[model samples]
Target: MYFSQNAIILVMLMFVVSAVFYSTINYQTKAVEDEIKIKEVSIYEKNVKNTIDRNINKIVEDAFVNASYKIMKSRKFFPNAKVAVNYITSFIKNETNKSLKCIVGNSSNITFDVGSFDIEPTDDPLKIRVIGNIELRYTERLNNGEIVGLKNIQIDKEVKLSRIPDPYVYLNKFYYKWEYGRKIILNNFPNDDKNHTFCIILNDSNFNYNRMYNENSPTEIRIIGRNSSTGRWNVVLPYWVQTWREGNNHVSIIWVKVNNKELLNVSEDYIYLLYNSTTPVDREDPENTFILFDNFDYFDPDKWNESGEILINNSKLTVVAGAGSSVFSKDTYGEGYELMFRANFSYTPENNSESAGLFNKLDDTGGYGWAYYGDGDFEIVMGDDSYGIDNTFDYINKTYIYDLILNNISNHPYIEYNIYDSTLNLEYSKRETGSFDGTYPISINALPPENKTSNTNITVDWIFLKDVNNITATVGAENIQPITYTEEKPKTFNGVIYYGVGAYDKVYNGTYSIIGLFTNKSDYWKYPTTVGYKPLIEEN
Candidate 1:
């Protein structure tokens, strides 16, 4: 019985040992399985989070790029609108690597100044405090707040966005609220201001300027253009907007450039002469020999229209054959007719050697085939049948320049002088080469002037000469007799008078002194330093 009991005990002990070992192995395997599952779940969650972050970053980068483009290169064309918004949104949602987000809308409650806003008058723009509401929209939130995806993951960063402020609802009122599709520039352009007080009207290209101005300075108008058939520019009352056309190139104010560089009229684009304006304030009456021509009655040898013979002045008129008298047309055949006066001369001499009858089938050059008589640079006038021999003299009508036709006679000479004092000297020349005739050229010099030009004020054009009697300075004034030459030369003549310096801008008045002598049809002018003095203007 003792042996049987021992055996049972031993078997029981083995069973307990085996049971403990199996339980230990099973527990280890279960623990290992749980650790493997935990690791796998952790990896999956990490991957998903990283992907979401990357996508967000990519969107932000795209939005930033679009916003940047708008501010830099595309604002002028597609400023703000659907296109811009779509561009920003698309970039934010589709861009890779960088995460971005953006929104666009308007806020009427926002207020901004002028310069910053691209505003037009149609907006009913308010002035002063420029009251309005502005809308703020999200534009971009870049990846990691970094420029591109080249860098390591960046942390959360705030993105910059545009905001609109309100101005109208009292200084402290919160009535100014922003919403989408509404934008108000509150002091937008900080330093800019909108001014539309005074109005400037521009005339149309087809407008008329005939009654624009009448001898008076335009008061109410700022500027004006003159009426011309073509290429005409004038200053008249009220500005002309005629130069501008609808949908044409941009127009300009102040000055018009001829070829895009050469500045033309300062105000008006054209200027015309008032041919029939009142006679000058100064000048002697004509002998009433001129007859006005109705048509452009311009022809050679028909100069009676522009001029006539004066029979009864103090002296008769005469000319030397060698001297050149430039006449538009002469009535040698008794048919007088002529055109408007530019300038010219006429003469009849007592001596045949000093005079020659001029006849031209056609018009001739200025210094060619002409007759002349008078003092230096003598301008001619008209009357009738006063050519006297022995007592015959070349009579000059007492008159002044700038007088509308001295007489109705359009037959007189017309000399539209084109001269220049280029060398700062008195030397001047007129060559027949300007026309078909290359012969017969002349050079007249500026005589020594006693009086110099004045810089203190506007220049005065007239000066009274001494001893120049019957020389009316104006409508009613008698001139003193001019100094006479003691001796007359047959083939020589001297021009110009010398006297004491008078007030600046006026003709010198005093005793005659220095003189210049030259042969008829001569090419050179003598400025004798011994007595001839050349006057020069004061340097600016």
Candidate 2:
């Protein structure tokens, strides 16, 4: 019985050992299978994640393109259209979801968030731009704190919009005026604003010309003035006018008269003059008949106001002055005059103490003068102080002809000082515009300081004063030209008028408004639109 029991125990122990080994092998096989299954699951998740990422990226790119097209189309229709971020995001989602739903098969897998978007007009008035940032999130659900697939797709986009040319009209007008002998007049002769009847009254009766007047058929009238003297019926036009002829013997007066004054009440509108002259007028002649010419042959006290030591030798007038000595003309010349002289300094000081040049409009206390200083500089002086500097030429013991023109005839008065070389070629010229405060007594002075170290001397070769006759025409100002008038031919005034029509967004009111207005025209018309005039507005 003990042997049988021991055999049973040994078999039982062997069976237990076999059962434990089989359990260990089964557990090891199961561990390896679990590892392979986990690896397979990981690979599958990676593929799904890659696909999701690609789909998400594609969706973002498509969304950006579609959004850009939408914004560009919208801006073409409405140039100043304001698109919100929510609207853009909604548009992108609607467009992308259509394709994304087919790819991903789940609406929850594809999602979008637009961070920012804006549409604004650029500096180019015809163009606008759209700029924004967007993010697309693609995700697939997995168990227990693990994400099988996830992708955050980002996109940045910019879009520029353009459009066709807008419609506009160009508008302008032509103005015409008649200038006659320092006077300007509008074309309405019978009903002029000044209400003066212009006529060419006979003065000497020496020359023969025709004077025809017909009250009923009065489109134009021609009258002749004799002897070139002041006639009885002399009228001055409102603006400055100039008319020139080669010889001042014969004068022709032409006038324009409307047949019906009531119908053509607008004088400043469309009246043009046709000038047909057989002889071209010489307008550059000096006006005054008398000219002051002196060669410094003799010292004439009747012509000059002399102070200090003045010497006249070898046909040259020399003035030696200490601190406060000057010599000027006794008679005063009017405006529109030029004073010219050739001068040389005996000695120019190294220090800035001496000055010598032409002084005009002089008095005891102060005067306006153009001077050359000791130190290579030219200056325009008002009394003791300098007003402007013209450093064109440095006067150092040289002879130069100086011409100073004072023009007070125009509405804008100006003074021009010119220096010429020894050959009378113009070297330097400076002009200034201002109100001159002195009368026209011309002088030549050698000025020195209070504590003068040396006496200043100036030698003048000759002095000449002449009157300037012609008026200089400035740009954009009234220019006068002489023209003959005939009954058969009349001048035509033609011009183009521009108008602009624009559609602008009333952003505050959320509506659009159309603006139509006239743009450019000549200075004749007072108002753009008349009492019953209406502009034709065509929409295209």
Candidate 3:
């Protein structure tokens, strides 16, 4: 009986232990299943958010493309500003609807808010801005019945509208007086109230050595003075009327009439007349400024002083120089001036010992200039000193455009030089700051190596010089189209357009996105007049 009872207790304990073990296993299994369900839901939500963000971005991009296309198209076809703006706005609205419909699929709840469009006008191009938002509603809903969606994705963008024959205006303060008379007077001067000066540029095709200096030749040109009153003309020869003669047939003269002289500004009412004895007047400027442009179409002997052995043919100036030879300009330059020319050499030297190039500030003593060596090197020289040596260039038989600028307005005057190789599309530039005394003139020099070729030939296409400060007008269009009726006309027009978008939930809770206001600029010129018009001519 006692053994039987012990066996029974052992069996009962085993049963209770089995029950506890089964219950613990079931609880662990349930907990694991619940955790897996939560993870699946979280991943699903993340995927939905990513899909919505991508779709929103695509919609914004499509809208921007559509608007830009319409705007550019309108500008091309329409000449009037208001008409173009209206057409573009309407087209964009229509296109935006179509683009959004295609992007969002067949969803009735998807909507777009196009914000205000902004447009501003300038002289050449129009600036435009666009802002807006997109709202997407999905059929799937959250536990609280909120629609799965993206709301108020904003877009802010800008673009420019360009036009052909852009609007511009030019002012004319320089002119040539060509009417013949014993007393030459420039009437109806522009900007008369401002302090003015006059420069008379004389060019005689038939001028000779005897006619330039002698008082007997009928072709001899002379400037006596100004008529203070109607009955009285004064014979005051200003000290600045200097003449420089090249060869025998051409004579170039420069005369300056300043405002401080009593003979010139006797009274603002009376016109200042120049008395010419014989030679026909070539050109005259009310402002004492001149542009020196030469293409060597025919050798204008009055323009340049040739040195060494120089040849002018086929619209080129070729200088053949030995060890020490140079060609200098007969005319002098001062203050704000820009000099541009093109040059090339026939051959390259084997060593850096030989040099040839352009020089300025040249006098009887020495000068500052730039030199190109036969060994593919370039140098800048001031007086007897040299700086900025670059030997890595390959300038053999290559044409290079040289642009030099002298700025003398500040206490420290500086020179800027730019060399452009149009053939190879390479550029090298240098700037030097120093004190420069505005005297002497410009020249071209070449030095050949000893025991080498006796002469090194340098060819120049053309040279141009102009006053930097006297840019009275600009030819802003091709074929010399008229841009403005008068100098006072407006050159640019500006305007703005606005765009906005809003999104709302079922309970009226909503968010708004705005493509904020932007501006566009349109530039235009007025109809041109003949009074101050000058054609920009290129010499071949």
Candidate 4:
């Protein structure tokens, strides 16, 4: 009985030990499997996280590049920070949706969200910083189970604006905020003259200068000469413009004093002009504002228009009229001009009904003039009749000087005529006519008592409109050729003209001077690109 009981106890003990061993093996196997599963999930999560990070970087980088190009293409430089940041952020989201597939180890179940963007200023003047948030969600299926991964990464990038243009860099190259520019070449310039006052006439025949100035506002025109020694473009100031009319064949007469030592050594240089809302430089009282000066050495079609028989001899313009004839100035005068005529009578009027003399205002409707009648009398005449007669004066063949001045004092405009004998140097007559508010051409006319009967003639020695300042200065004509000489027909000149618009913006609004290497025919102009900017070539 004791042996049997001991055997039973041993069996039971062995059974209990086997059960414990099996339990231990099962527990070990499960622990090892769980560890392997954990490692697999960790590896998959790491791969997805790395992929999301790489894609986020790529998307951000590409957005910056694309935004830069967009800004350049649009020519909207110096945009506000908000605008720039929005551009980058919007591009990134749109591009990611279109392309940018984030996959890790053939796992296609991955998605990302790009959150808001923040922009900050950098130490460099031309650089900016951008920060973005990316939320990535990844799901993958493994042999043991499924793995779900979530990551939130913040991306901070510094964008260098090296590709954009620096406005200050380009503005420093020019003397003014000139809107237009062109190249001019100097040839046959007098080398002997050290200081020359060049008279540059901007006319329709030479260039379309009417388009150069701002009609609605005051215009400041300038000539820029490049310095040979300093290798910099220098501004030429104290320049004068006698006439600047914006009409057909009208002129803008500019006189510039250039120092030979300071002028550009190269054959070509640039001329710049500006339009600003501010008042232009006062050139009215300057010595260089000569309205007109002509010696009549030769017949210049550009200066005079003659009708009937006319002859040029001994520096004289002689007009003979059997019935009626006239010589008139091509340019008409408005309110602020003075006409000086020097002439002698070639043939006095034959009778009381005949007349010959100078006219200050001439048009289709009878003009105001000083006439010598056939009765040895001088008269201030209107059209064919005498208004004010000077019968005491004797009419003879002698040189005489006449002046017609338009006075614009106190807003009341009137015409005054003064007659003097050149030989005696004494004033003969002075008269003030009624106020006339119109433009008229200067003319010399001769009228006979009857058609094709009386011999009426006059010879003009010289005629010129007096300079406004009334001071005489030596004028330089070294490189100025008024019109092409008869010998040099069809010879084109070597200068270009451009008028710019930014002067107004600079003067009135404090805008930066634009970089202009462009030629535009339209009044509107686009800004050009520079250092951190890009420019599209503006076609002429």
Candidate with the greatest lDDT versus the true structure = 4
Question: In model 3, what lDDT does residue 402 have?
Answer: 70
Write one digit per residue (lDDT tens) for candidate 3, span 305-346: 765567778998776655445567777765567666677755
lDDT of 2 by residue, 129-168 (tens): 3444434444445575533333344433333223222221
Identify the candidate with maximal TM-score: 3
Clashing pairs in 4: 164-532, 164-533, 165-531, 165-532, 165-533, 166-532, 179-500, 180-500, 351-374
Number of the candidate with higher lDDT, 2 or 3: 3
lDDT per residue as tens, model 1, 316-419? 12211222221222222111111121112332222111111122321121322222232322321112112221211222222111111111123333222111
Instruction: Please give the RMSD to the true structure for each candidate, in Å.
Output: 30.7, 22.3, 23.9, 18.8
lDDT at 249 for candidate 3?
35
Q: lDDT of model 1 at residue 95?
A: 40
Error of 1 at 248 (Å): 36
Two-way TM-score contest, 1 vs 4, winner: 4
Segments in model 1 whose C-alpha atoms lie over 4 Å from true places: 1-20, 44-55, 63-540
Q: Per-residue lDDT for 45-107 in model 4, tens only?
A: 565446545555566556655654444455444334345456667876665444434333344
- In order, the Cα lDDT scores of the candidates are 0.23, 0.43, 0.44, 0.49
All candidates' TM-scores? 0.21, 0.32, 0.33, 0.33
Quick one: ranking by lDDT, best first?
Answer: 4, 3, 2, 1
TM-score of 2: 0.32
Worst 10 residues of 4 by lDDT: 516-525
